[model samples]
Target: MGIVVNQSIKNTFITFVGFAIGAMNTLFMYTHFLGEDYYGLTAFLLSSANIMMPLMAFGIQNTLVRFYAEHQTEEEKSRFLNLMLVLPLLLVVPIFIGLALFYNETAELLSQENPIIFDYVWMIPVIGLFMGYFEIFYAWVKVHLKSVFGNFVKEVLLRIFISIFLLAVHLNWLTSIQFVYSLVFIYFAMMLVMAFVAFKVRKPEFHLQFPKDKKEVLLYSAFIIFSSGIAVLLLDIDKFMIGQYIPIKEAAYYSVAIFIALTISVPMRAMHQITHPITTDLMARKKHEELNQLYKKTAITLQVVGGFIMLGILTNIHQVYALLPEKYSGGISVVFLISFSKFFDLMLGNNNSIIFNSKYYRTVLLLGLCLVVVTVGLNMVFIPSFGIEGAAIATLISIGLYSIAKLMFVVFKMKLFPFTRKTIISLLLIALTFVVFYFWNFPFHPIMNILLKSVLLAVWYWFLNYRLAISEDINAVVKKGLKFNTPR
Candidate 1:
């Protein structure tokens, strides 16, 4: 808990800073500088790359975290790490070959709706390959329990670069197309920086031998590839499909709304950076009791924190939209729908790490694959009718069903549940705070209105959570902030 709290706080702060920069890029720079068409194209390319990333890395990132704690001897560890380094080539080499053979065909298929995408099609795999290895090395550091540096590089570095590049586009120093191409270079830079940091943490020993559990290791890695692919697919598929089904600009609009909604997941994302490795270690040691306790703590803490973020967004959603271009304001509903789904995911805390590292991971993979099919079908049925909002509907439904299924699986198989009385109380508090604030607004500028409303909401939300002691971890932080000591 100490390490989790320490790192999660730092990670959360760093992630929020990154999101702040990203918000400016998505909301203002991309909208104004790149215009809708190019913005959408940029979103589509990145989402497509994200969907391909899990496959390119061959799930070695997840495999490393899950298996790293099992090796006791340095030689054994070296063998396993060396295997992790090499295994991705099995998939990477073949994919590159296939891309080479069918580049034009692939480009044509993706660009049929909008020819602009054809030129950028090659960037998808290039960026995905960089992103895949970035995660692989990022996981390399996480296994050593040094996640902050990696998190900074992951969350902050690229967005900062994008901000500069977007500004360059505005200044006419770089064309919109050039700005798009810069994504490949920035991602490559991130991968290289992370690799350097990872080696600094612990330089890998080159070994020819494989771990004795090579069979189990290979099997787990195979399953993880599908599991990770399915998960990424659920997240990025909507933006990808939006480009295919509608004018590419709608992907840009959807991307902005999604970016706003994604803020709700920041706490979970930050916490997961450290919690994942810890969860993996616990599972490897078969420490069920500690695992369950960690599960509950992480669940409530994230719920409390994420609930506040969602409340802020939903209540100020209109004002937030007011700040965006009029053409982009249609995504207000998109923000609400996606934010709710992300909140549900936050409630499950470290559920993903727990399930992915467990024996029943194969079953979960099958479940995820089924959900992926459903998500695609729903998008097909809905996106044409509802537009970007339709894609949000598809995502909301798919993620809701998926989160529920994963929660049930963990409860039934592990007898571990993340919810408690506090969970119910937290939900009620969120609803209450939202009702009190949503209809109320300040008679001021949009920015001022958002600030005033957010302050009031934070005070109301955090004060009660503290009063009721919804989470000891959160309460301790509050107490520390005020420099108060707990009674003996």
Candidate 2:
């Protein structure tokens, strides 16, 4: 818990800083500098690349985290790491060949609605290749329990680079096409930096010999490829599909709402950086009790923190939209729907790490595949009718059903549940706070209104949570921060 809290706090802070920079780029710079059409194209390309990333990396990122602890000796560890590095090429080489062979057809298919996408379709695989290896190296550091630097590189440095590139575009130093092409270079550079940091953490010895458990390792990696792809698909497919089904600029609109909603998941993302490795270690050691305890603690902590973020976003959603251009304001409903879904995901805490590391991972993978089909179908049915809001509806339904299924699977199979009486109390507190402050807005600028409401919400929310002791971990941190002793 000490290491978990320490790193999570640092990671959360880093993630918030990253999000702050990202918000400026998404809300202001991209909107003002890139315009809606190009912004949507940028969003589409990235989302498409993300959907391709897992396949290109061949699931080595997740495999490393899950299997690295099983090796008992340095020789075995080196062999395992070597295999992780080499396995991705098994798929990457063939995928590249296929992309080259079918480049015209592939580009044509993607650019059916928007010919602008045809020229940029090549960037998807290039960026996805970079993204794949980046995660592989990022996972390399995570297995060593040195996630902070890698996270900084991931969450902070990448966005900062994007900001610089966008600023360059603003200055007429780079055309919109050049700015799009720069994504490939940016991701490739970041991947190399992550690789360097990973090797410095623990340089792997070169070896051709595979681990003794090569069969299980390959099997796990294979399942993980689809499972990881399925997960990524659930997240980014909506944006990609939006580009296909509607005007590409709608993807930009959806991206804005999604970014705002994405803030609610920051704590979970930060905590997962450390908890994933810890959860993998616990499962490897078969420490059920500790695992269950971790499951609950992480759940409550994230719920409390994420709930606050969601409240801030939802209560002040109109103000947020007010700051954006009138063309982008239609996504207010998208923000609410996606924010609710993201908050639900955060409340599950380390559920993903727990399930992915468990033996029943294959079952979950199959379930995820099914949900992917459903998500696609829903998008097909809804997008033409409801536009970006329809995409949000599809996402909300898919994620809600998916989250509930994962929670049930963990509860039934592992005899573990993350919810408690405190969970209900946290919900009540969130609802109460939202009701009290949501309708009451300051008669001031949008920025000032947001600040005033956020401060009031924080004080009221945290005070009750600390007083009621909803989470011992959170209460301890609050006490430590304030340097005060309070009766439990």
Candidate 3:
């Protein structure tokens, strides 16, 4: 918990900084500098690429973490590491060739509903290729328990570059198309920087040999691809399908609301960076008792943290939307639905890592595959009828259903659950906080109003949690921060 607390706090701070920058870009720069149409196209391109990444990487990032902890000798570790490095190429190279051969057709297909996508369609696979490798190298260092640096780069660096690119467009230095191309270069740069850092963390010990459990490794990677692919799909597929079914500008509108809601998940993302490897190690040693404890702790901690953010957003959302441009204001409902969906996801804690590292991972994979179909089907029905709001509804339903299934499976199969008495108490506290502060407002600027309300809300929320000691880990950190002695 020491390392988890230390790194997760730092990572959470860094991730918020990134999201802050991204919010500025999404809310102000993209909307103000670039027109809504191009903004949507940019969002569409990035979402499509993200959906492609897990497939291109072939689940090597997860496979690396799971197997790295199990291997003992340096020689054996090197072979396993080398195998992880090369496995993605088996999928990447063919995909690259296929994209090249069918580039025109692919663009044509994507542009049928929104022809604005044709010019930039080529960047999807190219960016996905780089993004996929970035995760692989990022995971390489993560196994060594060196996650902060990678987390900084993963969360911060690329967004900083995007901010610059957006400014370049405002300065009349880069055309909209050039700005789109610059994203490809930016992703590639991140891949190179990550590769260099990974090597510095542990120099390449490439071997042309296979691990003793080569068959098992390949099988895990093969099946884990579906699991990882399904995860990314659930996250990104909504935006992609929006581009297919609706006008491209609607995608931009949805992206803005989705970004606002996604800020709630920053803590979960930060915790997962460190918790994933630890969870893998725990399962490798079959520490079921400790695993159950970690599962509950993570779930409750994330719920408390995530719940605070969600409450802030839900309470302040009207004022927040009042500040946005008229074109993007219709996504108010999108924000509410998506924010709750993310909060639900956060409550699952490290459920994905737990299942992926366990022997029952294959069963989870099958469930994920089925959910993928359900997600697409729901999006197909909802996006056309309800528009962006419908897409958000579809996402909430699919993700909520999938999360429930995973939670039940973990509890039934492993006898582990991520809830306790404090879980119910925390839920009541969140509701009470929202109801109390939500109607309270200041006769000031929207920005100032949000700031005042959020500060008050956070102070009130944490004050009660601390007094009640909802989470020991959080209570310990809070007490230390305040220079107060811990209670026995």
Candidate 4:
């Protein structure tokens, strides 16, 4: 509890900072600076890269985190890192080649509405490979509990560069094509900086000391890759379908709306980064009690924290849309819909890390892939008719299915559930929080109204936690964190 709480504080700070920069770029800069077409183009290219990530990564980043502990010596860990580092090129280079082989037909078929997108399809593999290796390197640092620096690079520095690049576009310093390319370049810079920090934190020697359990590494890597593909497909397939079915402009609109709504999940994402490896270690030691406690506390804490953010978005969604132009306002529902999807995800706590790190990982991955197909298939069915709203519907349905499936696996297979009395009470309290704030519409300056309402919602969220005495584990964690921080 002490470690989790301490790490949570640092992660919360990082998430909030990252979010501030992200909100600046999305709400203020992207809309005010870049025109809709270019905004759509910029968003489309990035989504393409992210969607390509899991497939191109071939599971190496996740594999590294799952298996890094198997190697005890510096020489062995260093060699494993180098091996994971070079593995992506094998997966991604062939994907680039295959895509290039069918480029003409592929370009001809898809380029009708957005011809510019075809030109940048080749960058997916490059970006995907970088993201995969970056995570592998970041995982190296994560096990050392040196997450703050990597969090800055991943969350803060990248957004800072993006804000500057968009500002340049706003000032006519760079054209749209250059701006799109600049986004990719900024990510590459982020990855390089994180990799460098990982090296300095604990330099892994550049030797080949392959683990004796080569078979375990291979099995884990293969399963982790499939699991990652399912996750990537679940998250980004809607963007791909939106591009194919609707106008590019609609894809851009969905991008902005999803980005805004996705703000709620940022804290959970930050939470998972610190919790995943710890859960793996606990499970390895057969510490089911600790694992279960972590699971319950994580879900409860995320619900409290994530619930507060969702309160801001849901209660103030009207105001959020008010910040954007009218065309982008359709994503208001996307905000609600996707925010719920993420909330449901937050409710699952560390279900994913547990499953991936467990002995039954293969069975879990295969089952999850079935859900992934349904997600994509539903997106295919709905996206053409409703456009961005259709994409939202598909996303909501798919994320719901994925969440349920993950829970079922945990319950039936692992005999674990992340629920507690606090979890349910928090849900009801959040419902009340929304009711209280939603009707209190403040028509002040957009920024001021949002700030005041957000602060109030945040306070209300914690107040409810205190009132309900949610999760003794959380209370203990908080008590310890507060007491330890008290002056000696």
lDDT of 1 by residue, 1-488 (tens): 67766877788788888888888888999999999999999999999999999888988998998899999998998899899988889988998899899999999999998999988898998999999999999999988878888888877888888999999999999999888899999999999999998888878899767889988988988888887889899999999999888999999889999999999988888888678879988999999999999999999999999999999999999999898889999899999999999999999999999998888988888988999999999999999999999999999999999999999999999999998999999999999999999999989999999999999988888989999999989999888977765554
Better of 2 and 3 by TM-score: 2
Per-residue lDDT of candidate 4, residues 353-416 (tens digit): 8987877777767777887787778888888777788888888887787679779888888888
lDDT of 4: 0.78
Q: Which stretches of candidate 3 lie over 4 Å from their true place?
A: 1-12, 67-86, 143-145, 201-216, 274-290, 484-488
Considering TM-score, which of the candidate structures 2 and 4 is the better prediction for this target? Answer: 2
Clashing pairs in 2: none
RMSD of 3: 3.2
Which is the better candidate, 1 or 4, if ranked by TM-score?
1
**Per-residue accuracy of model 2 over 99-126 as CA lDDT, tens digit each:** 8999999999999999999988889988
The segments of candidate 2 whose C-alpha lies over 4 angstroms from its true place after superposition are 1-10, 67-82, 143-145, 199-216, 274-294, 484-488
lDDT (Cα, 0-100) at 221 in candidate 2: 89
lDDT of each: 0.91, 0.92, 0.89, 0.78
After TM-score superposition, the amount by which residue 483's alpha carbon in candidate 3 deviates from its true location, in angstroms, is 3.9
Worst 10 residues of 4 by lDDT: 206-215
Model 1, residue 334: distance off in Å is 0.5
Instruction: Give the range where candidate 3 is weakest over 10 consecutive residues by summed lDDT.
Output: 479-488
